[model samples]
Target: MKIVEKKNFKYVDYLWDEAKAATLEGNEVDLLLYRSNLLGTDLRITNYGGGNTSCRTVEKDPLTGEETGIMWIKGSGGDIGSLTRSGLAGLYVDKLRALKKVYRGIEHEDEMVALFNHCIYDLDSKAPSIDTPLHGLLPFKHIDHLHPDALIAVAAAKDSRKVTREIWGDSMGWVPWQRPGFDLGLQIEKCLAENPGIRGIVLGSHGLFTWGDTAYECYINSLEVIEMASEYIEKKIAGNGGVVFGGEKIKSLEPGKRKSQAAAIAPLLRGLCSSEKRMIGHFTDADRVLQYINSNDLERLAPMGTSCPDHFLRTKIQPLILPLEAGADLSDTTKLLGKLEPAFEQYRAEYREYYESCKHDNSPAIRDSNPVVILWPGVGMFTFAKNKQTARVASEFYVNAINVMRGAEAISEYTSLPRQEAFDIEYWLLEEAKLQRMPKEKPLSRKVALVTGATGGIGKAIADKLVEEGANVVLTDLDAELLKEAEGTYGKDEVSAVVCNVTGAADVEGAFRQACLGFGGVDIIVHSAGLAISKPLEETTEKDWQLLQDVLVKGQFLLAQSGVDIMRKQGLGGDIVSIASKNGLVAGPNNVGYGTAKAAQQHMTRLLAAELGPDKIRVNTVNPDGVIVGSKIWEGAWAEGRARAYGITVEELPAHYAKRNLLHEIIRPEDIANGVYALLGILDKSTGNTINVDGGMANAFVR
Candidate 1:
């Protein structure tokens, strides 16, 4: 429970040096950056973008030697771990603090936002954190505000005041739950004025605020406070068996079984969670998460409230407890999918009622009523968000809350702010306004897509375009190594790669299942997997024809059928774009196998379009010509053979082919990708049609 000394910490020197180099004029800004980064680097202290830090420093006018006191604080929506000079915004200290004196109660959100922005030292600087005024009113030179999990255990407890005294012994001041804004700032300033002896403040059901003359002191204070709270909980919960109440001991969810269940159930939940505004679900069977969600009293204890009020902004007040049996139906995907919608509907109805009960005339617009965090029996838990990072962020905080609640309950009964307070924090002007600051989502922001042959030129280009248009992609390819590389390029969340042999039913089905697991369900399918062969009628080998038919023809058929099944289960009409070739429309010597397979694939697209049109599913094709760049198919033997057939060297193939076309431009993979994207969703009413991407080849103009 002791503070980590500066000499004992290994990274302190490197961090301090880095902070000093980033400072403007090498002042206390170095201290602000150093201390803030130290606090942020530890997930035990604060999660991503969850806390704020500030310093009261002198801003020297370079032109005039006049020194003005300016408050430099963490800017809104900036992460503290990678914070730099730009992450810290400077505001006129007097102007910020003067609001305490001149403020009449301004209850409107816009008016308060305007007032805060007006106090900035310069409009050009990044916007100050909403908690800027709280730091300004405090007399300390340096301030650290953090939402440490251990602190939440104590601050969110029913006997928070008693626990606060037991942990810090009057060293910290206590304030009841108040949503973060001007009123909260005034209340904090009042608490400090009332308790002049306290060095820090414990915000009930919120976070901790500590300050010092030196940066090291403020940082150490937070560490020491957190360590003490952590120790207190550890001791209280020492040798505690699973909560045994009324002579019934909570059973353990066997780790091995829980993990298997989580993997099996995740895909179904993912598919169920998918909607018009797409959400990606992530599965976790972390020991802490399982221990809590599977506990005997979860039905009574879990839904009380969040571990802290601040978390309500991210995780809502409580998680949706999915009605999943512990052992039965754990591995049944169809059963889980069948039950998912009803469970979600019930959760939504209850959430809406909760909102209605607590809302006032001036409440902000309600966010998604669906619970972001879902907990089940042996399946552990799932978190759904717009993307993986956000889902992970929520999961991390939720895990922290679980540990905090475990500690609080071990000590005594765990409790948080009442419904009204929780509602206030959720709809508070400053917190709600953060949503408005987020960048606008693209049209396909919540949609998911699955693409075959995604490691190759046209396939990879199509995947990238879909991502740029705001769709989450599931990429399938025959080359496992190449698919892995492609997956790494777009980060963990945007694209997932599955090694798939499209001609094999098992592989195709597995690929579709993976698409469901990765992004709930596939809304758009681009079947780009194909093979080409060069052989004249006389030289054509049966083996060459079989290979072409297997990959170019059979592959499309398998992928289209599997993807359509997923779309049908989702009950959302989807787009299926087949990447047929320009060769399909035009006959050429030594290209019989390829041209024939492609022609059959195009015909299959038409059949699929006619069959699925009744179900509102659209089918289309993109016929791309000689795309040489990023094409492994054209770079080796195929390049030499095509060049030889055209009576030219391989080096002249690109320009020679380009000139034969009306536009005289060499078609790139991106050109084919654009056509594919247009067919997928952009051309909403267009289906059973081929969009040629051949730079204007009249012979390949769908004749």
Candidate 2:
């Protein structure tokens, strides 16, 4: 057994931990999982959910108490980095090998997938991935199929086989591009037979495959191959004399300027990309991304598309590039905005053409023609998807593609897969079947919501509910610490916290900007930030009245003003729900200041509804009678003033208010949240109408 010498790595990190491996000495499957985790977690090794690993282990057969060969491989749609034992599909090796005898050729390879289920060793294991043959048909005890950018650069080069020989000589084998299936697996097996003593094979315009007798040896083989490729590409890149991408036609914008520019145009780009369905966006101005988009060859190379199947699948066939001249003014948002729609439309038209030209008799209908990725010179790259994680992962994949192009172009002319081949993989019926198997999207899926006063009871409840329904939420409040605490309650991908004083114009604008950067843009706005000043007519000072108006009325106005601007730019209609008080309509005593502000908020909803009808922006109000439980207002002097006015103790406010309502039901913050959710999700058509969630307060009814 000849061991390959490990070279010192420069571009990729060597993360193998012998100490950790020792703990799983007896469990070969656990060791394989450990190796998979170390490889998958690093974007340099492979992308998210883009690679597969397998170990052929001897396990006791459940039917017969005898040891049998079982190949444990990554299941469908599982990310290797976060893969669990249950995520591995265990299939009988003998059965999998037997199916090869019945293989009917490349055209009938997809039928082989259904047979894989019959080979499952564990009835409860996850469904097998399409690339199972690439791992199962191999002779080695352990195998790895990865899509590292460095290796893919060599694989996607114009003279890929020649480059493979130059880099690894006869030590590594080379195979031509073949879509993943039984046929590709046979080609790999044949490559190994023809080239004895080869450590791995680079699949043309695809990825890399390596194998070993032991799990540890397979891990080392995979790392060594990637590291050597990285070293070779880096040397070639350096020899190019800093003239990669035809020598940077446009300089990168400064960090601050680029991000601000990204924030400025993200909503517009998001809107354009969301023509089919609403999308969440992820933006990146990383040096590598900026270098590619700002380069002279961007126009020439971007349209050729990515070579790897995993790469193009996430990014689409090509990205929509926003053309900007050298030394272009990024500050003139109007000019940048003007160029967006035309470019977007052209991209869509080209996508439709590609689909029409390449469709087969059984091809799935064309997917969204809207580009998943959009690149702007000097600014950066923007990727949109159904959710934040997918959007962010798409950006990461494009960056990987950029690195691949950089390496390939340095060594040789980069070559993408042929249009027909790319289209076949993109619209494969199996791929469509996988998509159909996906769980139904939640009601609020792809919608981004911004909730003001999010740290408060009603605000927090509304934010939580929105997230539960699949909406990414931006939680804003005046208190930074509370906002941080509130954000911690939800996953970072689902919620973002911004400290904002809604009364300040700059603060409101800045909050919206953060929301745009965080989750593309806002589709729903909830104005729940307010304070109460319950004072008798004589006792109410000018200061009290102004304070209430500023916090309640003025704050709601500022949020609406900023939110509407983003919604209009998105070209997607939006929802604005204000949490007003029943006092606004009831005109109760000792609540002059609070009642006046509430009335203003309620009327503002109606007025905005009438004005924003043309834009499809709905405005409504949720008037609560007495949300005394779990409410911040009840914790302050407002409770004391209300209690004094009602001639009752503060402790009795909940029971007293609940009894006064028609249903005698105490209103909780969640009840108010449900009202807001109903307005946004179910009663979407009803605008300028008040839905009184305060135990059916008759006085607050809209007549």
Best-fitting candidate, scored by lDDT: 2
Please write out the lDDT profile of model 2 over residues 208-251, one tens digit for every residue.
99988877899888988998898898888788776789987877
Alpha carbon deviation, residue 302, candidate 2 (Å): 0.5
Q: List the residue pairs that clash in candidate 1.
A: 270-520, 278-446
Q: Which stretches of candidate 1 lie over 4 Å from their true place?
A: 1-27, 61-65, 105-111, 239-276, 326-338, 430-432, 478-481
Looking at candidate 2, what is the lDDT of residue 246? Answer: 92
**TM-score between model 2 and native:** 0.96
lDDT of each: 0.77, 0.89
Off by over 4 Å in 2: 1-8, 325-338, 537-541
Residue 75, model 2: Cα distance from true site in angstroms: 0.4
371-436: candidate 1 lDDT, tens digit per residue:
788888655678888876777778888887786677678767788678888887788766667778
Give the distance in Å from residue 327's predicted Cα in candidate 1 to where it truly belongs.
4.5
